[model samples]
Target: MTARGYPKSYALRRGVILRAAVHTTMLASEPALGGFLAWDGTDYVLNNADGTYAAITFDGSDIVGVFFDAESSYNPYVSGGAYDIEIFFRGMPPRLRSLAERHALAYNRQNYQCRSMALITAAFWSVDDYLTAAFPWEDVFRHGAHIVRVELLGDTDEAWQEWREAYQCSPGQLAAARALFWRDLSK
Candidate 1:
């Protein structure tokens, strides 16, 4: 049985299936269902030992939101060091279900891009790092700021303060870092 805070009634009506993100990952034991991931009972950390798991969040015939996590998420960008993934659009009408699902998938694509910096060249740590690296992601971050409302952040703010307090800035280094840090990242 799917646990509480989970969907108990879902029969794949109209090819729309809602996946739940249960910490226990008991959903994996069910037949034909794909793998999954869930929080560790001890902490919010996604436990590797127990394998991927999640529980459905509805019961009976009610059509609630689908609860899901990295394992069940079709987004390829998710499993890549994205520790924080919370996409919720509840209380929407059933007619908009398709649109809601699509938005949920894309709600955090920019977030994934932000986290991907950690995996890229070791030189890129924060805005300071990007400045030091000749300001990569210039176009993406710039477009993000200039066009849409996107918050590009990492350790840049804190690093800026630290740099202000700890050491004097060279004109070139400061300018380069500042340009990428202040301008390119945020509009």
Candidate 2:
């Protein structure tokens, strides 16, 4: 059973795990669900699982946010080095915006910056195409931020090199290439 208390769905694709962030009031209201875990004030993890759980935090009224960590021991597949991925958003919804605000506050308070930065190059082909894309750059980047830094927790040097070559971006050229890619995709 997944942490949401539902049987793990075969339909659910697994790659990177995600979690929710909630406010104290919400935690107080739903002790059974929220009490099972503790809030580090930055991110939440499963208390009982062998480091394999992801959670989201919510405000008293609604789900406010979600995030992930690099050091989670549950999935060893996450690389020690940076993994190149892109998150694009069509637009930020109210719920997502609230979550983002909380995530930023927590990240700043913890001083949890990515030691290594990962490059994401995304383009929107079609709405459906964007939805079908493995990593939804359109949806993830909807805040209008030109660039974002991501941490890679599950990739290897060889794999990173291969991806870089395929994308044709050196570390220096990554930002420009990503911008161009996104621009071309928008059309």
Candidate 3:
């Protein structure tokens, strides 16, 4: 079940351009890389919907995650750099990652899950007037946001499949999901 292996150890070196701990102040100056997901200890660090880092507790159902290190400072991979990228593989709350693994590409959770919610909203477009009120996304979204444990929802394939059917994801969405599916965090 170990998707990828991590470095036995990572030692900080001089002037390492990217991949520093999250606390590095220089991260602000570095060009924005796409969101970074990793471990800052036992907890998991995820890019929140609002452009902030979120730390989620782990459960068995979470998708595989990674932690990269050894850089003198934290620099997101998107910041132009020549250094080799190494990752320490693990997991946390795999909410989005889980969807990606399921090939639900267009289901972005960014910006308060707007993209996902939009898909659900679109599903309503196809709903009959009588069943329109039966759209269940609100319950799903609410449970995801309010529940302290991801296990209550966003924890199984069945839940995601329902959303996938409701949204009627496009080919682009499938591609996106496949692209984001798994983290190859091996050294």
Candidate 4:
């Protein structure tokens, strides 16, 4: 069972289905779903261990969002490291998540684009919920923000944050981490 009391099999099935959907969406070659680095006629593709990829979406030259593809995400800190893998399976560290987020914010800021960042993922991975809920979702949806309001997350950011925080043993998230890190992963 998951921390939310979902059966492990159910979660795994949902993950597989969601991954297929994401792959299909990417293959459709929709301009809105194109990789962020498309300006140079190339993409900043983040490859996963399973040979799948997560690409950033852009509106014109401004990056708007990214989907967390199945499998562990590649370490963006390592240049020319698309194949590099995260140590943990099924999810990534929250700190790394934060780092990538900061980099994205900086990138957008430097480029004078919207500072908004969307983390779109099917919340089937072990720590996906914990990571995605760390930030508040924007209520007023931007041009490319529609996909961020996917199924797993709650209708409102506050509601999602409450669920995730309680599940992660929060009040003090770091303290909870020290006491209960990966404790419910077997669920």
lDDT for every model?
A: 0.26, 0.30, 0.26, 0.31
Q: Is candidate 2 or candidate 4 better by TM-score?
A: 2
Q: How accurate is candidate 1 locally (lDDT)?
A: 0.26
lDDT of 1 by residue, 1-187 (tens): 1231111122221111111111122233343223223222211111122222111111223222222223333233444444332223222344334432332222222334545311111011111111111223332223121111111122334534444342344455445545544342253
Model 4, position 108: C-alpha lDDT score: 26
Candidate 2 Cα misplacement greater than 4 A, ranges? 1-36, 39-45, 65-91, 103-187
Candidate achieving higher lDDT, 2 or 3: 2
Better of 1 and 2 by lDDT: 2
TM-score of each: 0.18, 0.26, 0.21, 0.24
Most accurate candidate by TM-score: 2
Candidate 4 lDDT over residue span 1-187, tens digit each: 3344422333332332333233333434344434332222221333333423333322222222243432323223223343312222124345544443543322322111233433333221223322222222221122122332332332234533543442342345433432332232333
- Reference-based lDDT, residue 49, model 4: 38
Clashes of 2: 29
Over 4 Å off, model 4: 1-22, 25-94, 101-110, 113-145, 151-187
C-alpha RMSD between model 2 and the true structure: 20.0
